[model samples]
Target: MKIYKYKDSVYCDEDLSCEYDNYAGDLYDLYLDLKEDNKCGETTRYYVCDKYTGYDEPEELIEEEFSDLVIGEYESED
Candidate 1:
């Protein structure tokens, strides 16, 4: 799996065959909990890393709050 760090959150990129939806949900939940606990930075940041290539453009990353659908792209295999 590829780990991308954007601001305070880290996104994991996994293969298409892998269960990315479940993982994304889990990560979002974790992010929420962390935010509530003040574990995340004030920026409210997150990332979208590729699991296979472990590659993510700096511009592709997102931070400061995001929609569930927006995050879904990170989980996408394509």
Candidate 2:
């Protein structure tokens, strides 16, 4: 399970271990709560999962679900 921390929020992959539908709601709530406390710009966390595979469980799934999210444009291959 890999967590990509973006400038605004985090992005993870939803798999059998991590269901987006279930977590998304709670995550949104947390986002709102955090926004209320922190006066910074609002950002949203997103889960990228396979539409075919109903497995949306753990945060680890993000590695296989979406690799692109981890790779930054300015990051070197080395």
Candidate 3:
């Protein structure tokens, strides 16, 4: 699903798919940009992934905060 940044909550684009129902919360690793892999290819821009699951909900962050939400290359190795 294509994720959207509006206000402070990041949510799955309602127009994208139902895999997420406009979910807006803490994602362990929220990829600000894109990542490529051998298996999934160019998938999962934002993920509350297995090993990367968050301990708490993310607070309202501004667009500038995207840098702080970085998901390292090795991190998204799902």
Candidate 4:
């Protein structure tokens, strides 16, 4: 997995078996950005995930956020 800090938000490259929808991270930051700019809707979903689970629903993903987690070393491109 590749993690990128782009545009004040952290993005993680995900292998979700899809070509287009392959990134998942910084969801909470994005929600805050949208809310701060008054661009979010009432039905908009919010999340705070630091790990990947390959789940489709937000509720299930959030549930597995902290289970059996491991820290990995990620080198920066600076």
Tell me, by TM-score, which candidate is best: 2
Question: Global lDDT of each model?
Answer: 0.37, 0.35, 0.31, 0.37
lDDT of 2 by residue, 18-71 (tens): 423323222233334334554222214333322333224333234444444452
TM-score of 2: 0.27
Ranking by lDDT: 1, 4, 2, 3
Q: Model 1: which residue pairs collide? A: 13-50, 13-51
Candidate 1: where is the Cα deviation over 4 Å? 1-25, 41-44, 47-78
Per-residue lDDT tens digits for candidate 3, residues 1-78, read 235443444543233223335445332223332212211112233223333323222222212233443322121224
lDDT of 4: 0.37
Give the C-alpha lDDT of model 2: 0.35
TM-scores of the models, in the given order?
A: 0.25, 0.27, 0.19, 0.25
Which is better, 1 or 2, measured by TM-score?
2
Clashes of 2: 13
